[model samples]
Target: MTMEQICIRLVKVDMLSPVRALNRFPSVIRCCASARTDLMRTNSSSSLKSRGSVTAAASSLCLRSRSGLNTCITAFRPPAERVPLIIQPTREFHTSGRLRALPAPLIWMVLKPLQKLIAIILGRSIRKWWLALPPNKKQLFREWTWRRRWHFVGAGAGLLFFVSLFLLTHLDESPVTGRTRLLVFSRENFMELAQVTAEAYMEEFKDSLIAPSDPRHQVVEQAVRILAERNQDIAEISSVPWTVHVVDGPTINAFVLPNGNVFIFTGMLEAVADIHQLVFILGHEMAHALIGHAAEQASLSHVVELLSLILLTAIWAICPRDSLAVLGQWIQGKLVQFLFDRPFSRKLEAEADQVGLQLAAKACADVRAGPVFWQQMEIYDQLRGEPTIPEWLSTHPSHQNRVRQLDRLVPEALELRASCDCPALPKADPRVIFHQAVKLLLDNAKKQENIAQEKKNEKERAGVILPFPQSPPVLTQGSQPQRGGVLATSALPQTLLSK
Candidate 1:
C-alpha cells in the first residue's frame, strides 16, 4: 500500500475519550511509496530478531521527541476488546501509544466552561422557584428580578429607618457635661425607681447598719452631705430625700440611688486612703444617678434587643426558617451581649468618670485621690491574681484603663482646684488609714463596755435588788454587733441580688 493509504488505516487514541480517537488519525499523511515499501518488508528471520531492538530504539526516540503524538505501530487486535498498546514499527500497525494525557491547562479549560454552565443552570432554577412565589410577593420582581437588587433595597430601607429614629428624638442635656442626649425615660421615672429600690435596700440592710457614731459612717456622711449639698444640679441630689446607710461588710462597693439614698460597704472605707478618697468615690457613684445612666442604660438595652429581633426577622425572611435561623440567632445573641451591651456599659462608665471628676473638683475633694483610689483597687485585684478579662468581653474597663483615664482627668481637676480656697490636703497611706479606722472601732467598743461596767457597778453600790440575777443582754438599736470586727445585716431576698 502507499504511505497515504497505510496512514489511513492507523488510529490515534485520544486519552480524553478513547472511543473518539480513531476519527482524527485516519487519512492524515501524504503518499511516500519508497518509505512504505521499506517499512513493509521485515520477513527474514535475522531481521525479525533485530525487530525488537529496532522497536525499542524507535519508541525511545518518540518519547524524547520535542513534538508529541498519540501514534505508533504494534501487533493487531480485534475491534471488540481493549487493544494492548505496543511501541514498534513493522509491516502491520496496531493501537496508537497508550493515549497521551491532556495537559493541565487543557483540563482546566474544559472545567471552566462546565462550571459556568452549572452556575447558569442553578440560577435558572432559582428563578423558576422565585416565580412560583405568590403573586403579591412577586410584585417587586415583576420589573426587577435580579437577586442583588432586592438585597440592596432591604439594606437601604433598614438604614433609613435607623437614621430617622436616631435623628428625630428630643435632646436632653447631661447634668455635669451639659452634653445633649436622646433620653427615652423621664426624670420622674428615675426618682420613682430610686424611691422603690432605695426603700427596699433600706428594709433589707436595716439590722447590721452603722449609725452616725461609727467613724466610717461619720466620714462617708460628711462627704456625701458636702458633695450633694453643693452639686444640686443633679435632680436626684436636689429633689430626693437624702439618706446615707453604712453596712459593715467585706464587699468593696458603693452605690447611690436617684432618691439620694447611698449604700457604702465598710470594705470600701477600709480600701480608702482618707476621707478625701472616700468622697471622690462617693462622687463617682453619685454621678451615675446624676447623669441618668440607669434609665439611659435600660432604654439602650431594650433598643438593642429590638434591633436584634428585627435583624433575626430579616434573616428568617431571606433564609429558610430552619437551621439557618438557629445559626443567625446564636450569632445575634453573642454580638448583642459582647458588642452592644459590654461596650455600651464601658461608655457609660467613662461618662460617669468625667462627671464624677467634675463633681469632686467642685466639692473641693482632692481630685488626685481618684487615681489613688483606683490604684488601691488595682493592687487588691493583683494580690488576688485575678485574670483580667479582655475589654471587648468585659462589662467594665480594665483597671489599667481606668487608672489611665483618672490620671488624664487629674490635671484638669487640679486646674479647677487651683482656683478654690481649700488648700491641698496632706496625703495619708491607705493601709495606715484602714488600721486607724479599725483601732478607732476597737476603742469605741472598749469605751462602751467600760461605760456599761461602771453603770452596773453603780447599780450594785446603790443596793438595787435585781429582778433576775443574770440579765439578758440588751442589744444596740436596729443592728446587732457581731464578733471578729465583722457586722451582719438582714439582707434582701434572693430576687434583689439580681438587681
Candidate 2:
C-alpha cells in the first residue's frame, strides 16, 4: 500500500477516538514501516516514481489534525520542502472555524504558567543580587532606605487619604438615628443579596415553617402590622415590603432580612412573657431592616477584606521567611476582627436596640417592654447555665449592657410616645411585674420542695411501716348494704320476693 493509503487508514483509526487512536498508534507505525520496506524492494528500479508518489502522499496528509499531524507528517519529508499548517491547534485551543480567537492579552495567562514563572525568576534574581552585595554595601543600602523612609511614609499617607475620601463619599445616614455609616451597596443591591439568604432559610426550614393560617404566623403578622402601621417615622416601614414567616422551632430568636422579611421562631413566642415583649422583639428586628444594617455591615466587611488583603500581600512580599508571613497574617486577622469587625457589630446591635425602642414607643406597645425584655433575657441566660461570652468577643452587646442602654433611652422613648398621641402607659412597670412573677414561681417551687422534705422527715421519724389496705369485695348492683357495711344480695325480704 502507498503512504496515502496508510495515512487514510490512520485517519479512520483516529476518528474512532483520541484514546483508541493513541493505543493503535504503534501498530500503525509498524505497518507503515513494513509497507515502506516492501515498496522500496519492489520499486527499487523506479526510484523517481516512488519519490514522487511519496511526496504527493505526504502533502495529502498535511493539516490532518492541524499542527500536531502536520508536524508528524512533515518528519517523512525533507525539511526544505515541508509546508507549515495554517491552522495550528497548538497556537489556539479552539478548533471551530466560526468562533473568534481568544483575546491576545489573555493568551499568555491562559496558555502559560506566567505568574509562577515570573515569581520564580524574580525570587532567584533578588537572591542572587542580595548575595552578590558586600556587607558594607548592604549596610549602606539599609541606611539609604532608612533615609528615604519618609518617602514611603508619605506614599502610605497619600493612599490613606484617598481611602478616607472614598469612604466619606460612600458614607450614608442610617434611618431614624441619622448615624452616618459606610454603605457601599445600594438598597436594591443589598435587597437582592438578602433575597438569596431568605431563600436559603426558606429551603432550610421548609418542613419546619408555620403556615399562614397557623396562630404563630398570625401573631407575627399582627405584631409586624402594628409596628408598620402605627410607626410611620421609620422610613423603611412604608417604603419596603414586609413579610412574616414563623419557624416552628425552639430557637428563641427573631431576625429581619434587608428586604423586610421577618422570621420569628415559635421558641421566641414561648420566650416572651407577653404580647408587649413580643412587640418589642419585633420592633428590634424591624429596626435592623430599617437602618439597613446588613448592607452597612457588608460594606464594612468588604473594606476590611480589602485592607486585610493589602496588608497580607505586603507581609508576604517583605517578610524573609514564609513562616513569618503566615504568623503576621494570623495576627493581622485577629487584630482586624477585634478592632473593627466585632466592635462594629456591637455598635450596630446597640443602635438597633435604641431605634427598636423608639419604634415600639411610636406603636404604643409599652416602651418599658424594651428594658424588661432584655432583663428577662438576662435572667433566662443565667437560669440556663450557659456560659456567657465576654462582650468584646461577642458580636452582640451583653444583655446587661443592652438593658442599661434601653433604660437610658426609655425617657426619650416615652416622650416620643406621648407626642405620637399614644395612650398613657400604665403605672405598673412590666420589669417589676416580670421580676415579681419569676420570684413568685421560684418561691412556690421552693415551698413545694420544703413540704416534700418535711413529709419525708416525719415518715423517717415515725420508724413504723403501714400495712397495705384490703380492697372492698365486689358486689352485684341489686345487693343492699347491711349494718356491717357488707353487701347482702341473697337475703331479701319475703314481701319483696312475693311481689
Candidate 3:
C-alpha cells in the first residue's frame, strides 16, 4: 500500500469517537502490522527472506494484545523511519511523563490543615455543648438577643476588656530614658524585622555602597567605637555589636536599625563640619535604637489601625452613599495622623535629642556642638531653598525647635561631661563663635544698606557700586572680648544664643 493510502486509513480511524476508536483499535493495529512488514520486505531482500521471523513477530503481537492492551502497544515500537498509526486508548491513557513535584510552603501547608482541624473540632464541640444546654436557657438566650440586644452590649464590653488587658501587659519602659510606651512587638521580633528591613536597604543601595576599605568607613567605625566605649553605662549601647555601612548617595541622612545596623550617606558626612558633630549625629541615631522606638511606633500604629477599622465600619454602615463613606475614612485618617501620629513622633525626636546630647558629652565630644549642628542644618535647609514644613504636619520637630531644646540641655550635658571626667571643654564655645559670625554678617549687611542709600541720594550716581565685605570677621581669643564689647553679647550661660 502507498503512504497516501495508509494516511487516509489512519485519518478515518482517528475521526471516529473514542469508544468506536477503541473497539476498532485491534483491527487498525493488524493493518499497521501488515503495512510495516510490506515496507520492510520492499526495502531489503534479506528481511523478506526471513518469513518465519516476520510470522513469529506478528504472532507474538497478537498473543500479547490478548494479555493486556497497554503491554501490547508499548511492546511494539515502530522504526524511526516509519510513522506510527492506530494510537491505543489504553497506551495513551497509561503513558505519562515524569511530573516534577514543586516544593510547597511548609508554614502554609501545616497551617491550613491544622486550622481546618481546629475549626472542625471547635464547631463540633460548640454544637454538642449547645445541644446539651437546657431548653429553658436556650429560650432565654434567644429572647434576650431579640428584645434587649444583650449580645451587642456583651461583645462591646468583652472587646474593651481585652484591649485594656492587652495594652497593660505590653506597656514597656525605656531602659535608658525611663519613658513608658506600648510595645506589643517583642524585642526579638523587632530585631528580625529590622534585619529584613536592613537587607532591603542594602539591596536597594548595593550599587552605591562604599567599600569597607574607604577612609569614610574607617572614620565612622572609629567614631562609633569611641561612643560605644565611653557610654558603656548604657546597657543598650554596650550590649549589641554595631555594624556600619556607608552609602554613597546624596541624601543627607543617617539611621540605625534596632538590630544595631547603622546606615550613613555621604551627603550627611559632607554636611557635618567636624568629628564632634558626627559623633553627636551617630549618638542621636543610636538613641532611637536604644529606646526601641521602632517597636513602640509599630504598636501605636497597630492600635491606630484597629481603631480606624472600627471607625471605618461605622462610617460605611451609617453613610448612605459609598462616596461619603470613603470621604469620612479619609478625614479620619488625616485627623489621626495630625493629632496622634506626628505629635508622638516629635515627642520621640525631642527625647532622642536630649539623650543623644548626654551620650556625646560622655564620649568627651564637644557638647556645645550639638545645638550648633542643628543651627547649621536649619541654615543649610534655607540655603537650599527648601520649604519649611509646619511642625504640626511633620514627623520630626523643626530644626529651630531642636536647636532651642538642645540649648536648654547644654548646661546639663556639660555637667555630665564634667562628671565623666572628660577633657575640659575649650573656653571658646562653638555657640559663641556661631553667634558672633551671625552678628558680623548682620553688621556688614547694615553697612551695605547705608552705602546703597547714600548712592541713591547722589545727584549723579556713580555707576560703580561697592560690594559687601567678602571676608567674615575672625574672632580670635583676644578679639572675642572686643567683639562682645561691640555686640554687647556676653558668652555667659544665659546669653547662649539659640538658633
Candidate 4:
C-alpha cells in the first residue's frame, strides 16, 4: 500500500492499544521515520523548522529499524517547533536500514494466546497450578484453604484460653524481686529431678570426692551454708534440704541443682585466689535454684512439646506430601525450641546473676568479687583456646558480659550489703568498669540483641512463631498456595528465621 494508505490502516486498528501496537510491531510502521527518512515522510509544516526547533506534526507512526533492529519513536517537540514531527531513532551500530511488516492476521493469532496466558497468570498463577493437580490433591488444597480461613480464629481463641489457664493456675511469686511468676511444676518436682541428677553425679565421682576433713572441703561447706542460710529466708525459696560436696576434679566449675544439691570442683576452689570470689560464685549457683530456673525451663519445654503435638496433628491433616511433612515437623519443633525457648533460658541465667548478687550481698559476702571471679573464668577459658561461642549459640553469656552486668549491680549490692550490716568492701577501678560498660553497650547494640526484639523480627520468615502457640497452621491454598507459606515456619528453626 502507499505510505498514507498504510498510516490510515494502522490508525484504524482498534483491537490493539497504542502502546501494545507500538511494542508488537517492530518494523515498517508508516508516516514518520529517523532523521534521514524525515525529509520524505514528514509533513510540509515541518520543512520550515530548524532541527533544534522541531515540533509535533499530525502525521504519525513509530517504526523499529529491521536492519539494525533499532527502535525509533515520535516525541512532541515543544509542540513549539509546533508544526513538524520529529522522530528520535534509538539505534544499534549496524550500517544498514530496512523495514517490513508481518501480516496482521498472523500477528493477531500469535499474540492472542500469549495475551490470554498473561492475563490468566497475572498474580494468580497458582490457581492454574491448583487446577492441574490430581482430584485428590485439589480436594486437599480446598480443605487446606478452609482450615486456614477458619483455623486462625480457632487458634486465637485457643491461645487466649491456654494463656489464661497458665496465668491463673501457675501464679507463684518470686522472693527478693517480689515479682509474680508462672511455675507449672511444684518445688517437690524440682527436688525429685535434682535428686536423680545428683545421685547420678555422686555415682560417677564417688571415688574422686574430696574428704570432709580436707580444708578445701571444709571451706566450701561453710560458704555454702552461709549463702544458703541467707537465701532460705526468701519466701520463693523452699527450705529444700541442702547437701554440699567437693569433687576432686581439675575442671573449674560449680553448680547447684533445683533441689539443694551443690557440687564444687576442686579446680574451681584452686582457681579462686580469695574467699570472696568463692562466696560470690556460690551465690550464683544457689541463685539458679532460688530463681526456679529449672522449673521455668521445664515449663517452656512442656509447652513446646504440647505445641509440637498440635502442629503435627495439623500437618497430618493438611499436607499431601507425606515424606516432606515429617521433615517439616522436626524442623518446626527445633525452631520453636531455639527461637522461643533458648532466649528465655538466657534470660533466666541473667536473672540468676541479678538475684545472686542480692543473695550474696545479703549473706555478708562481698558481691563486688563477682566481676573479679568471672574475669578469672574468662582468662581460664582463653587459655583452653577453644573457639569462643557467639552469644546466639551459647547458653551462658560470655564472662565479659557477666562482669559488665555485675558492674551495673555493684552499687546496689554494696548498698544492700551495708543495710544487712555486712563488712565494707572496696570498689574496683572506675576506668576498668567504665571500659567494660562501654564495651557491653557496643556489644549489645551490635550483637546481644534483646530476645523480644529477635522474636518480633522476621514474621514473614519460615519457622516464625505462629501467633497460635499450640494451634495448627492454616494450610489453605488461598492464603499460602506455595509449599512454605505457613507450615514452613513450623518446620524451620530459629536459624532460618534469624536472618
Estimate the TM-score of every prediction. Answer: 0.53, 0.62, 0.63, 0.54
Q: Give the best candidate by lDDT.
A: 3
Candidate 1 structure quality by residue, lDDT tens digits, 89-171: 22333577686454333343356546434543454455457657998778777657575777889988999888567746735
Error of model 1, residue 301, in angstroms: 2.1
Clashing pairs in 3: none
Point out where model 2 deviates above 4 Å: 1-150, 317-321, 441-499
Q: Write the per-residue lDDT of candidate 4 for residues 1-499, one digit (tens) a residue.
A: 6665554445345223434555555353423233324433443433222233233343333343335442334434343353333445444674566753443333433665564344334323444455468999888878888879768888889997987887688878765666676676666666666676788999999999989987777777777777766666675454677788989887768899877788999877777756666777788788888777777676656555555555555554455554665676677767876787777778877888898888778777657667877775665555455577887776778888988999899998889888876554555653366358547755654443444345556663655665622211222112311111111122222211121
Q: Point out where model 3 deviates above 4 Å.
A: 1-146, 149-151, 456-499
Root-mean-square deviation per candidate: 29.5, 19.6, 15.6, 31.6
lDDT of 3 by residue, 1-499 (tens): 7653563355344433433443556555545455554434343422222222322333222111222333222124345543333333443235679873422222233455464345434444555566777999999878877886787889899999999998899888887778788987777677766776788998999999999987788778777887788888888888889999999887889999988899999878777766778888999999999888877777787677666655655665555555776687679879999988999999989988988888888888888988888887776676555788899999999998999899999998999888887666679999999989878876876777677566655624656555533322232212211111101212212211110
Off-target runs (Cα >4 Å) in candidate 1 are 1-167, 233-236, 316-324, 426-499
Q: Any idea how many clashes model 3 has?
A: 0
* Clashing pairs in model 1, backbone N/Cα/C closer than 3 A: 207-479
Candidate 1 TM-score, C-alpha based:
0.53
Clashing pairs in 2: none
> What is candidate 2's TM-score against the reference?
0.62
**Judged by TM-score, which candidate is best?**
3
Estimate every model's Cα lDDT from 0 to 1.
0.61, 0.68, 0.69, 0.62
